[model samples]
Target: MTLSFELTQSVAILGGGPGGYEAALAAAQLGAEVTLVERAGVGGSAVITDVVPSKSLIATADAAVAIAEAGDLGVQLFAKGAHGKPLKPEIAINLAAVNKRLLTLARQQSDDMRAALVEAGVRIITGHGRLDSDNAVVVSTGPGGTDFDRVEADTLVVSVGASPRQLPSAMPDGERILTWTQLYDMTALPEHLIVVGSGVTGAEFAGAYMNLGATVTLVSSRERVLPGEDPDAATVLEKVFTRGGMTVLSKSRAEKVERSGDGVVVTLTDGRTVEGSHCLMAVGSTPNTRGIGLEEAGVQMDASGHIRVNRVARTSVPNIYAAGDCTTFVPLASVASMQGRTAVFHALGDVVIPLDRRRITANIFTAPEIATVGWQEKDVAEAHINGIVHKLPLAANPRAKMMGVRDGFVKLIARQGSGTVIGGVIVAPRASELIYPIAIAVERRLTVDQVSRVFAVYPSLSGSITDAARAMHHVERADED
Candidate 1:
């Protein structure tokens, strides 16, 4: 297919993920002709497989958890076919329907994003796009990716996100051995699911399947699950996992995985073995930087294959930018969108505001979800950022008491000298939503006193957040006195 380049200023964005598509919309809004090239649909892995699918399944699992505790609150759950007769409560999950719903929700979200971009007058080309010489993008088209199209642009934005990193010894067959992306495709709940690499992804899935009534064995190479998260929160999660019939093996690294008599065995590096009906590897992700012509185009990248970009998302090559997981930065959907927008603004000659890494919030979507923003306790202890920390238990909140929540807390970090809200962490249900106010406080440089003054609903989980801030405010006052 032959198509002429737009005479007006055009931005060609590769990868229709959060970073790429968001940049396309922003550039289109900025009066630049934007064209987005993507092999997959819009919204990328966040909507397609990683974020949306996993979280949607987590919702189902969380509902099961809540229902399991309904009897304590005088709510009786009857079997659907019991005809009003009380029988033993059962949480029977339809794996086929669940997987179908997960995939449907993901594609629907991708469709919604695509419709928005189309409405914004962005031309979307379906293909694997790569940087070519002479300020152009070569899109590999047709059924077999042989036919191609050379598209012209004034500037280029590369936002192709990363993929699940595979191990040579333990290869995922997308059936017995699976990656996080293929987990939702299973037709049946694994009888004994063995999860390796207990990072955010592994912990979330392991907790979710356990809630869904699966026998789970969590293999953590580290001393505890979610090693990157807060120690207190990780401790709480590990406790919950162990209490919920999950067998957690700490400091055990899976060296090889093989099929053994219709089951999977994960042999540890220490010569130990874990056997299960299925296995999932949540090791990490590798950036999709190869064959994108990034290096040939003179774009700088770190040794680990992530593109090296500045605060404004500029690469080593002039007029070319890299954003999202493709760059060596925090892998958050929100952060990726901001990086994409920042790149588009700088490229389109608009006012450029560099991304603030400190103000970003990250959340792990396991039960009793953990969310954090701004300076961490380690950062303060290391003198990287000075902050006073105050923690309040969720059990102290009236709403938490009503909801029977007992295993979570809120921690607020305020600047030592100014008492300005610097960072905070929340370990509770919907902590993702809870972190927003803390993020706003940090972003606006609001003080602990100011945050505490903001009226939180009485007896609510938000009250715990405010209480933590109040505790810090009191400490600041006492220190000043």
Candidate 2:
């Protein structure tokens, strides 16, 4: 039961993302001398570029949507100088202000992380850390410098996160052709935006730009947008996007992206071209595995370049572990944190729990925020499970109507034989928050009746979840009759 490692030896963590930093903190708490190395600033891409900045941009767009819908509450609008003329609604989003706030927030996060690590007595080194051997790491400091530092460690945790994958034909110019990481640098809003992928990142940016007063065209190679998410939820999102003046081109593949005189052109595989003021490449991400000495140290990686690691985050090498997007696990901040913590416990020979992917909850942060947990309907149908799926639309919920939310629904999947809830999906504003209760239910194997007994506040959006549970109970009773 002892979680402490020998004080004589030290632990080294590579990359300063959520995974690596969490592991460093845990190791330090367990009385292990820890050294964390990062080539980029602390907090990594999640805090500086991807998650924090995108969510902040979304918050701005949400505020605009709220202001535009104020007339539904019987609020009157009048011009300042005119006698009775109604004022024309305008949403002016200053990109400079937004970018300034983004940088400020990112710096704050970095400072807080550094302070925490320092408080825990963990040494922070700003350098590129690569494994020289199973127990040795070489650090290269200050990009384009000759100085290097090498250190030996008892245990190693690799959490070097993923980077945006770019196609050979579509190199980013940082002005016209941009990646998600570079979008915050835009000072002027694009008049017409062409988004070249339909995954979570693509869909989110497309929806956000469309809401922020830009004409968006979402090009998807698959038959539907957000192919990795629930089919029903994706369908709802596609419908909402289309209704909001977004031109979604499904089953279309972009062969190459090139810059026109003043704009950009995306040539499709089917001999069609789409033009826009700017193009965003959201194809996917690749793990930062190459040139890090993973192969030299005998650490295994998958075909897609993701490091192969066990449930407890151990790699092929006994003392080496990998976590976060670099490992072959669900690429999420929450899962990454858990994987990092698990690696420390397993390495220290403490109480370690293997990762359970089924218990994990994920969300696509679109306008309505699609969130899900546990089994999916497609998996249940493929397995031929006798389960009932119940859906309750937000249209029927009073709280949604009051809040001016017209789209989205809550769906519950339960075993027909036992009426035990096994999976759930929520597509609503703040659906990420709403899905956690259902996630807890599914993880605990709670029955539909048990979920129904929990009182949801009247005139609250979560009431739809309870209503879905009741509907499932009604259907079960009807089947028996």
Candidate 3:
């Protein structure tokens, strides 16, 4: 990548998210006067309310699970184990204190990022920003939102992000019926939690709550949870959920959520009713694209209202670019940052490569997290180039056996003739941490043999990664015979 080019133009970014701040820094580094306008403090929903908060909640749940399963490992502080009789210990969770810590950590991260941007000579404005006419931006501040502001820019980047989707039939009262972001406001664990829509967010919160001693019910409209993920991996996760005593109502769609006394009742399309102490609506998210004056500025948006952008993050209108969940692309914080940086490079006339979405690594933070990178098995043209799909279960790994872990595996997708690694999937505890090497292989266009030859630590879960790659190579060699 070029260090810098003729990128001396004025750049203005809207939203203080990963994409917006990253773009500001990149533009500033390229000798441009950069300014970032944000309504929230910094870090966007990813830090303030959504991603970081949920992950922190999951961490607490994981700790609870570790202690609950301590007996199975022959390490017990109590007389409860499979070696003896399973003891039922009443577990208590302080959700208020938990949420407080989560928010604290989130704010601290935002503050740290703010310090870095200020040090980088990027001007920060605390306000809601909107596009004005002809390469101009208007930022409004103050409690009344009447605070005046004007910004002149040679280029603009919009990364306003998205919010939780709300349904008319199932409106959230922020009490019994809640959105994902409102989960942190609880002071106690819900007795019977009904998670509607078993997507990644719904599944994660459902599993975490179940681990924390709550009786959980997951309502899914799809045939299985994580309908967008690999079917095999989704099956493994669904099995795990069932084994954990979660009531999975598959093919059930929520029609309405109503309050009954202090509890909530969810009505399904097929005349089924589910009652729970609290209802979590994880239907998906709507982009925060309304009232941003984007249409007036002539920036094109998709039918779903997400800004349309090219691989380099350029929008239909010249001098304007879009990134993050607000755009018509896959949403991830890492992808947003890369798109932002790419937009700055393109705007500044610097030599830069367009973002390759196929190389994007995605981690779904479930108990046994699902992580994948590059092209999938379905993506390979088997007729054109022979593709091999090799999977190695973690049960065969020494580490998994030692830890009494089961129900996850590593899968590799490769072209048998060329041995070129394309995609991989890891379905195990901490799979999120294991998908990097596969991503690197895809990025560098490494062969299966090359990945297999790399050394992974002995008696480790990661050994499955290289070992699976090696297994693919063996199959390829066998096909040659």
Candidate 4:
């Protein structure tokens, strides 16, 4: 079927993140003229600062860990020494070189995004855009600076994105106290790193830095790490981190951060102080909703400054819609892209699939990556169906043993009565890549028996997944008997 829309209406998408760009592409494909206005580069925070850079840094850290563990697999290294005696192997990392490569890759991604949008016939405008009214947007050539141009559109998409939330007492100076966005500017590695929060971002940075040869201390206000993730996954991560020489301070909330000589001191709410050569505040992100003309234009926002929108991405005001991190929806690149597409679909009167929060999969990129889908363990415990949890340790897998992987497991949660897979958690090397089959299983409501029938490679790490499914099947059968 040919999908077409009335060309009379035009759309102006503000902010060029995954949401904005994807929405622009969708709109253009549906025959609506689109103009994308962005203050930063095309890929927004996901590319220019946060996700791309941090993941690239994590990749380097993963490589370092792999090298360090190579010796266990009988790999030996030698260096030239006096009299041909055995020499200690040295691994050197150039921070500047890593940053250069990271920025190069990020820029390439941004360029590709721009090229794709252009090819889709969307006009790209480099500026900070704000809605003047329901159907008009004023674009400023610079952020918080004057030179403005107003563009009129029949449909408005607000994908203004978000910024790093900063506490007044712990303001980031881009030096001693830093945000994740500022880490790319460093030419040298930190001697000691203190990461505040213990959330996904903090845990990820702490793990990455520790792997990269830095002494890391993770401070969390909660009783355990990763309060937002599955308890089992969090417990495994905490154990792995402590075993890897990371000092974790749970139930400790940072009250203030102050510069001390060349380093910084983070004072806890309990009056205890922790000092480190560098501190990264990974508390959370704030929506970029301030000064965006939302109130004047009758667009509604929630208490947390996120724009209020329905499943279709429609704002309180008709003809105005919001998507991405700026909206009340969960902040993820995948969710943002879907929200964008949904907004365009609803706006153009096309077949629209409302946003499904349940099916979205999220990953935390630590040494042993954590990936989850569908209902969480906490939710399953409180639900109607009795849940069975099966965990298969990677240590028992032949491929994991061969690869020298000691810390990780594949966990599957299934409904006790129906045997339908409800959720899955993978904690292992390349867990991100290994999570697709589980995600598909959960999405399709596949039974444990069905999942177990799929043949995984013998002696492969992925075999653990199938093994976990089989274990779940055994538990279900026992329960039935």
Candidate 5:
């Protein structure tokens, strides 16, 4: 049912990304006048450049990986040789065609999102938008950005997303040196790609490109890749990387990246150099919150320029709110959308569920994807949570064995005594999908025994989750006895 308030509220959203888009739609549905001001096309960088395109590219790479894995499962492609002998068909990726397909997909999604907002009675302004005050947004629109438009509203939502961080020592030229956004422009895959960081973004692109038939070199300043991820999951990925011919330079930091003839050379902080056809700088991102008049409008921000927001996605200012990467919350597209809706609901006097970090499900899209939710095993080890850990390898799963899957496992963390499921990590193909049920368990505070009672498909990857939960339950019973 659409909310009908006596006084129609007006919502002004700056940035048409996931956060702003959702906020605008929710506000309009609640009988509010919504205006969304966007510099980029609708759906923002998440759709047009970053998330959509990257995931699509990774999907293509995953297809390539499946073809190779298919051979291991006795599914082979063969052609008649000159002497009438069977010849194994080689797996190849036309990266140019793949890039075109993914970009087209991104554009189509952006257009669809735009259509949805329009259908919801939202007024969208295409231009650079900034806070004129807490009550108004000023947009520089039309004809070389000379024309100006102003939107005044009762509530303001800021979801202005973030940009790839660029270092002066290693600047991107959009050719040899590039950011994650510039990757879709390459017609051909990089012959040798040197990824400068080993975080989620870096590991994802590195693994994707390597699967797409590129020599990958991952440079990490830390002792291992995916420094912040579950250590066991990281170990599996690093092992897979090396096994797939990727050069992992753990404990190495790139000081500067310079174009060396046709390729690029990355000089390490310790004075060693590595050369590659292209370099991807996945260092991190900075919020697009600078010069946006946020501070002037009395909205508080952190030292890094991220807008400070409460659990309900509201800023310090009564009428102003912030969401997405620009906010001080967890930087995930899913989290951003939730924050946006919560902000609108709270402002319009509707029911709101405050955002929680433990309830969020996160995934790293690699060959064998790593997905996690709630408190981790490390949290238990550090005495943050009284939890018991249980792990089950996918190799032991009936479906995994049938599919010739040898790597990856399912790990469950439960309350030490009560057996209430608190967190989980899955390292397998499409771990993103597998992690959802665990997220539900965490959110609903389901006990391991309760989860074990639910029947999963006989021969499926998700069986591992149930299997792990049952093991945890057994452990709990043993403790009680």
Candidate 6:
């Protein structure tokens, strides 16, 4: 179907984050005039504060872990002493320098994304933007909030994103008390970081800071660190955290966090108190969908204010679409990008594939990253899917053993009778990369037997995936018999 116009169709996107940027680019490529208005620079919180900087920081932490593990791999460092007796080299992290490097990298990425958007012929407006109606956006730009730029368009996409949820009892002062975004400001590694909440964000930071040589106390209200993830993955990570000297306080909840002299004190609901130099509130985030004129424009939203969007990223209003954390879909950068592209395609009469939760890839950037896609073992147990599971420990992998890696595993889940790949979990160094093939299998609905036949790099960590698939070959054989 063609746009009902002799002239080029116009599209306006508010908030130039991953979703907005992708939407603008996609719409522009489809022969539409696109205007992208952003409060911050391009790339939004994902690049500027959240994902990029945090992952870079985790990379530094991983480097620290590598140096410590190097000794186990027969790689040793020695320092000359006064008595001529060699002393083991101390691992020290120059946190200020690391923070500076990561911030610079984040800025560079943001700049690159902005450059790409400009090169794509998308008009860029730097300002705070809000929907004026279903067909128009109003931006507050220039000095002292005194100027305004209004854009009217044929299609509208909202990707305003979300912010770290703050509680009244524990506010982020950007110093002693911190949010995930405020962590890069520290000049020194936290002496003792009390991380509240045991979800992905909390577990990641707790593990990362501990690896970086900080005394970390992880406060979890749940029974495990990653309550929502695979239990086996969480068990392995919790073990690693304990082995690395991190204090995992499961079943604990922080009632309040207050400044105590130069440090902070956290009070628990059970009348317990924990003291630390800094506290990171990783409770979760709230969507930035409030007061955005979405309701005024007849856009439907949930009680929590997340914009409701269909699988194709379309809102209740036919011409309006929403994506990213602000929407009711999965809050992931990759998912956001896909939703953006899909939204534009659906809007402009192009082919579009609705998003599937099972195809989404999620990873926790801890020491040994946990990556997952598709159906999980929990789903089978909960009767959500009829599937079988096979698990192979990384320790049994030739490369993992050779590299002195002692933790993590590859778990694959497949349909009971058909053996069709459904979901998987990978817990290993750079599991994010390793989980891609499994994702492909799930997306293609390839059976375990088919995946087992694929030649994985011999003596590699990924070999465990093939091995696990091979071990589950009996499923296919049983059906054949």
1-481: candidate 4 lDDT, tens digit per residue: 3365545669999899989988999998888889999988898988888788889999999999888878888887888789988897877778888888998889899999999999988998898788898899999885576688888998899998888889999999998899999988888889899999899999999999999888999999999999989887898899989998999999999999999999999999999999999999999999998998999999999888999999999999999988899998889888889989999889988899887776778899998999988777777677755788888888899998788888888888898867888888898888888988988988888888888889999988889988888877654553332
Predict model 6's lDDT versus the native. Answer: 0.93
Query: What are the per-residue Cα lDDT tens digits for candidate 3 across 109-164?
Result: 99999999999999999998898875988998877876869999999999999999
* Runs with alpha carbons beyond 4 Å of true place in candidate 2: 1-9, 82-86, 384-386, 474-481
* lDDT per residue as tens, model 5, 1-481: 6888787889999999999999999998999999999988999999999999999999999898888878788888899999999999888888889999999999999999999999999999999988998899999997787899999999999999999999999999999999999998898989999999999999999999999999999999999999999999999999999999999999999999999999999999999999999999999999999998998999999999999999999999999999999999999999999999999999999998899898899999998999999999899999998888998999999999998888999999999778889999999999999999999999998889888888999999999999988887654543331
lDDT of each: 0.89, 0.89, 0.89, 0.88, 0.94, 0.93
Locate the minimum summed-lDDT window of 10 residues in model 3.
472-481
Off by over 4 Å in 6: 1-5, 477-481
Q: Per-residue lDDT for 1-481 in model 1, tens only?
A: 1123355688999998989988998888878888999888999887898999999999999998998988888888666555666577677899889999989999999999999999999999999888996378999988798799888899999999999999999999988999999998788899999999899989999999999999999999999998887888899999999999999999898999998877899999999998999999999999999988988888889888999999998898879988899898788888889989999888877888888788989999999899999888878778987678888889888999899887899998888868888888999999999999999999998888888889999978999878888777654543332
Q: Please estimate how well model 4 matches the true structure, expressed as its whole-model Cα lDDT.
A: 0.88
Model 2 lDDT tens row, 364-383: 98989999998788878788
Candidate 3 local Cα displacement, residue 240, angstroms = 0.8
lDDT of 3 at 272: 88
The residue-level lDDT of candidate 3 at 226 comes to 95
User: Best by lDDT, which number?
Assistant: 5
TM-score of each candidate?
A: 0.96, 0.95, 0.95, 0.95, 0.98, 0.97
Clash count per candidate: 0, 0, 0, 0, 0, 0
lDDT per residue (tens digit) for residues 311-351 in model 6: 99999999999999999999999999999999999999899
* Cα RMSD of predicted structure 5: 1.8
For candidate 3, report its TM-score. 0.95
